[model samples]
Target: MGAYMSEKKYTKDHEWVSIENEIATIGISNHAQESLGDIVFIELPSVGNSVKAKDEICVVESVKAASDIYAPIDGEIIEVNNNLENDAAIINQDAENDGWIFKMKISDSNQYSDLMSEDEYKQFLEQ
Candidate 1:
């Protein structure tokens, strides 16, 4: 796997996920941000909200358009990055890391293994 994508899994919807302990950190992939252009605002979910896999968990608005960010797996949101409220451009600056949208207490760890690996995600994007 590429160095940056080492622990990250990509979704067809342009989201990326990385699990540490039982917490799954979720964010949009770099490709998603590039497509969205300059980000302006974000609507994050409440910290204690429970979400199912594929649920729309957040909305990211950018200069070009607004896009919905979905949950990659079933989980309860444990925390959200409030930093984005003041400066949403952080996503444009770093989509995969510092721009992470939320972290959740995973309900099913096995669901993570089903996401695309970096290489697979690259191929998916090419299709």
Candidate 2:
């Protein structure tokens, strides 16, 4: 597994969010990418799009299947990783870092508290 940031929070759907200065950087968890196999394409939301907690904000296509990537909190998208448009396999190489899908200005920081901690998420995966 790649190095994971201690501050990152994860969703049941296998996305991760790391917040700093009210901006949340979002990405699919390593588990998600591993389950999906070799990712071939990605459909990301445009910058400035409004997304609610649990909203489907993107899609990732892999050799195994296409999966919807959900928002972990309500927010306005501030940026997206355009690099994925050309080489989606970056997700397979490192889902936690360069594979990040987008960044958003969170609507409510409190929403982050509800997400699973790294340990909780690891336990969830074990279940």
Candidate 3:
């Protein structure tokens, strides 16, 4: 594979986004899953659904509560992680990687730059 395509960016709400070839992969952060605890269900967005940045994209339910996942950039949903349908705990195990929730072909790549960097996210959490 080519060198890593993009740095992951984060939302204040704990979603993370990474873009490659115009497609943005989105997932909740580890802190989010840990806080939610033992995710039990996920309602994924449909492929082809168009969304604006900050729009509610899906829902995740844990033993503790249900959390909303938001779109980090304007886009049309292109794919979702089907594994989550049967096993929502995948997110608890790897919120940033194998547990990615959806992929969307972004409407504006520039929006990626506006999100927090990993360092900024960590500092935000510390605060």
Candidate 4:
């Protein structure tokens, strides 16, 4: 839908991460939100929590389904997108930008290498 999202890394599970300034912004992909439909609630992790790669950190519930938002890397949770609690549709409206699920201080940037790049993720979808 809408050509999917651009310029973001992806996971086999369909999570996406955008890296900037050693901080990672994470969310589900556009295709994910389109498929989930009419998001109604989000459950985020508390601040100051430590998260490991692939950890289940959030739960996003939509009219069609509820899914876990996994951690793409090991890191401590510096900030959760509090805005989502009040406006979960922000995620459906702008999954990559204002709707990002969380911002984290990465524990090892090198670990990011294990994730799929935008191009790689695109290929994953083609499969």
Q: Determine which window of 10 residues in candidate 2 has minimal summed lDDT.
A: 1-10
Per-prediction TM-score, please? 0.94, 0.94, 0.96, 0.89
Worst 10 residues of 4 by lDDT: 1-10
lDDT of 3 by residue, 1-127 (tens): 7646699999999999988888889999999999999999999999999999989979999999989999998999999999999999999999999999999999888789999999999999999
Q: List where candidate 2 sits over 4 angstroms from the true fold.
A: 1-6
Question: For each candidate, C-alpha RMSD in Å?
Answer: 3.7, 4.3, 1.5, 5.6
Model 1: which residue pairs collide?
Answer: none
Pick out the ten consecutive residues of candidate 3 with the lowest summed lDDT. Answer: 1-10
lDDT of 1 by residue, 13-119 (tens): 99999988778999999999999999999999899999999999889999888899999999999999999999999999999989999999999978999999999
RMSD of 3: 1.5
TM-score of model 4 relative to the true fold? 0.89
Model 4 residue 61 lDDT score: 98
lDDT of 2 by residue, 4-58 (tens): 4339999999999998878899999999999999999999888989989988888
lDDT of 4: 0.85
Error of 2 at 68 (Å): 0.4
Over 4 Å off in model 3, which ranges? 1-4
**Model 1 per-residue lDDT at 1:** 38
Candidate 4: give the clashing pairs: none
